[model samples]
Target: MKFMHISDLHLGKRVNEFSMLEDQKDILRKILKIADEEKPQALLIAGDVYDKSIPTVEAIQLFDDFLCELSKRKVQTFIISGNHDSAERMAFGGRLMKESGVYVAPVYAGKTQAVVLEDEWGSINIYLLPFVKPANVKRFFEDEQIENYTDAIRVAVEQMKLNTDERNVLVTHQFVTGAKRSESEDISVGGTDNVDASVFDEFDYVALGHIHGPQKIGRETVRYCGTPLKYSFSEIHHKKSVTIVEMKEKGNVEISTKELAPLRDWCEMKGTYMELTEKAYYENLDQDSYMHITLIDEEDIPEAVRKLQVIYPNLMKLDYDNQRTRGKAAFLEAAEVEEKTPFDIFEELYEKQNNQEMNEEQKKLIHDLVEKIWEGGH
Candidate 1:
């Protein structure tokens, strides 16, 4: 059985206050095209179908169109809710949709539901474990000791009673231990939300989501498909793709990735203000691409971002790496006055305020005040 694994769609997401709807539409179409060419039996969307719990109308319609087309093609689909998704909303018409070969995992309570599909070899049981927490698991398994995210997920998987004799696939949205995170993902502090990869040892393949970078965890069978488009400047260099998995039988699987091309790529550019503005330098580049530019010029450019927007319409961020900025850091570090005596400190302050050393009369007055304050134990 062949299927495509993708996650973190984050539809209707906006980067730097710029809407990504058009880019999302373009990428979804590309995914459809890949689906057509690959002709996979199913497409597995692990989680994060929308950018927010309450998505915009356009986001809903866009996802609807994608699903409608898949239904038309008679392709099966499996989806689960991520941290950013409202499970109740995502599962609103899940029962009805399942009748048409679309399976959406409901908000997990106690038992995780598995959708069984059969191939020539045998039946492949696909388990859907949506984003879970300790509290969610504790409510159902009152007797189980679910202390953290790992314990919660471990207890939930144990209740599934998975049969090792048959091929089983697990689809979940989680922060698997050791998986690298991108700036775009909302991660918890101190790795408190991490789940161990060993918990999924029984499954033939584990499809994961949540982390924005596509990568394998522990073994080749467990993987995160990543986002289709870069959502932050930190992900400027990511080569986004959809994972393709082909399972012939129990413990026999092949995995590959299909690259996705966005309407405009996310990139970072560094140069002097003059160089960046020169027609010769930027004339051939893709002005529509999202950009994070760093200026290396010493002098500040007035309305730099506004002016750059004329040539690069999608410039998202601007920063300076010039001498003045560098000197400011050095000056701050060198100006530490903790070791100086109060009189010395006052003298430096007087010099700065008056552009000269303190006069004799002023010095006498300050010395008298300091002596009086010291004598009084202040």
Candidate 2:
């Protein structure tokens, strides 16, 4: 059985105030083209279909179009909600949609539902386990001892009563241990939300989401197929792609990836102010690509961002890294401050603030105020 594993669509996302709608549409078209050629038996979307719990009308329409196209192609789909999704919203019309080969996992209610599919070899039990928390598990299985995320997932899987003899695939959205995170991902405060990879030993293939970097956790079978587009500057280095899995039989699987080409690539450019704005440098680059530029010129340039935007229309961020900006360490020099008296420090601050030395009259006034305060304290 061949299937495409993808996740974290974040359809309505905006990167640095630039709407990704057009880029998302272009990428989804590319995905559809791939689907047409591969003709996979099913497509697995692990989670995070939208950027927010309450997706915009355009986001809903875009997703609807994608699903409609997949249905038209007779391609079966399996999807689950992520932390950013509203379970009730995602689950709406799920039963009706399942009739058309699109299966959407409802809000996790302690028990996981498995959608069984068949090929020439045998039956493939596709389990839809949406994002879950310890509190959610504890609500359903109050008697069970579920202290953490790992325990919660373990209990949920156990409830599925999976059969090891048959080929089983689990679709989950979670923060699995050993998975790297990107800036766009909503990470837990600590390791409290992490689930051990070993907990999914029973499944033949585990399609994961929630982390934006495509990577395997413990084994090849357990994987996170990252976001198709770069959602943050931190993900500038990621070569976004969709994971394709081919399952021959139980314990026999092959995984491969196909690159996703976005309308405008996310990138970082660093150089002096003049070097960046020069026609020679700017002409060769994709001016429309989302960019984070670092100007290393010692002197601040007037309207630097505005000038850069004239050449690189999609400049998202502009920052300076010259000596002036980088001169100050985050911490103050304690010894230098310690050497000065309170009055001396105050006088230095007054000069810096006024951009001039205190006149004799102002100096006497400050001295009198300081003396009065000192006498009162003594």
Candidate 3:
């Protein structure tokens, strides 16, 4: 059985305040083109179908058209909601859509039934596990002690009663431990949200989402297809593509990717104002590609932004890297709260308030509290 795996569509997303509707529309078309050539029996959309829980009307319409096109091609499509999506919204009319070969995974409620797919090799089970928090699963299994994300997912998979004798494919949305992070993703404090790759040992192919980079974790069978387009300058180097998986048997699987080209590339450059503005620099290039330009001039360029827009209309960001800016002294030290865990920030506050560091016991108490809060204790 062959499958086309993709995720993190992030439809209706705005990067640097610029709407990606057109870019998204273009990419979807490119994916459809790939589908035509590959003719995969099934399509696995891991998650993050929408940029938000409530997507724009345009985004919804765009997806509807995409689904319609897939149905016309008679391809079986499986979709799940990611951390950014509202499961209730994604699962709406799921049963009805399945008649047209679209399987939308329902909201987590203790038990998740796998959709069995048939091939010449017999039946392969496709399980759908939407993005879940420990709190979401803890309530249903009061008897189980779900202390963290790994525990939560481990418990859920155990209940699936997987049969190791047959080939199984899991379509889930979660950040697996060891996957590289991207600037545009929303992750938990520290690495508390990671799900151990060992937890998915029972599956043959684990189709995953949430992280924006396309790569495998632990084993090649477990993979993230990544986004179809670059969502941030950090992902500018990413060769966005659709992952194609071919499974002949339980252990016999082949994986490859069909490259994608967005409407405009997300890229960056650094040079003096004069060099950047010269016609020789950008005249032969696609100036409309979204850009982050760093002006290395020693002095500020008057109305540099306005002048640059004439050549590169899609300038998403502008910055300066000069001696004056780099050599400037800090006005006040600011903590990188985004990079700190909840407990780490709390400890800093405790030390500043009492003019003393917390003891091991106090630290333990706060650490436990932080864990509890993430599990919905507060």
Candidate 4:
């Protein structure tokens, strides 16, 4: 069976306060076109269908149209709510929609049931597991020890009662440990919401969401299709695409990606104010495309944004990178921040503020407090 895997559409999203409605509309149209060419039997939208739990009216209509079009084409779409979505809202009308092959995961009330599809290989069980926290899962299993995200997921999977004889595909939304994150994704503070890849051992293919970069975790069958469009400057270099998955049998899964071409590409240009404004440098480029212009002039320009608007009207960001700006102390790199826990960062901040490392008593207090907070999350 062939399926198109995509996630984090983030419809109705705003990048640097600029609405992405038109871009989103256009991208969805393109995805529909791709679906036609690929002729996939199913489309897996892992999560984050909307940017907010309560989306704008226009955003809702946009998705409705997309779904209506998909239904018309007789393509099965499977969607799950992400952290940004309200589970109950996403679950609404799910039963009615299931009749049309639009399977929306219900607000996970304990166990996840499978939507079985048959092909030449026999049966493929598609399981929908929405974005779940430890706190959410612990309620259903009081006797189970679900203290962390890993524990929560393990317990949830345990309840699924997966059959080892058949092919299984799990569509879930969560931050699996070791996935590279882009600034666009936003994050869960304190590092308490990470699931281990080992918990998904039973499934033949795991279609994941949350992380903005398309990647395979541990094995190619376990993957994230990533966002269909770039949502932040940090994602400037991402070659966004739709992942196509082909499952042949119980033990065979193949993955490939088809790159998406957005309506307007993201661009970042850097040069001295005068050089950037030069006619020769600006004429050939697609000035209307969303862009970040970095002016390296030693002194700030008077009305630079206003002036640059004449050349690149869609300037999303403007800043300097001159001697004065470069003189400032550097902050921790994203890699460094990812390596340190929130508590570690907090302790470092305390020591820097007070000019001394935390004493043993303070350390113990902080440790206990962190532990309590982590438990409360579950």
Highest TM-score against the true fold, candidate: 3
lDDT of each structure?
A: 0.90, 0.89, 0.92, 0.91
Per-candidate clash tally: 0, 0, 0, 0
**Alpha carbon lDDT of residue 311, candidate 3?**
91
Off by over 4 Å in 1: 327-378
Give the per-residue lDDT digits (tens) of candidate 1, residues 168-214.
Answer: 99999999999999888885657899999989989999999998889
Of candidates 3 and 2, the better by TM-score: 3
Task: Give candidate 2's whole-model lDDT.
Answer: 0.89
TM-score for all models, in order of appearance: 0.86, 0.87, 0.88, 0.87
Show the lowest summed lDDT stretch of 10 residues, model 4.
326-335
Better of 1 and 3 by lDDT: 3
Q: Can you write out model 2's per-residue Cα lDDT over 230-314, one digit (the tens) per residue?
A: 9899998899998999999777899999999889997799999889888888889888899999988888889988888988889
Query: Which segments of candidate 4 are over 4 A away from where they belong?
Result: 328-378
Task: Determine which window of 10 residues in candidate 3 has minimal summed lDDT.
Answer: 329-338
Question: How far in Å is the alpha carbon of 275 misplaced in model 4?
Answer: 0.6
Specify the highest-lDDT model's number. 3
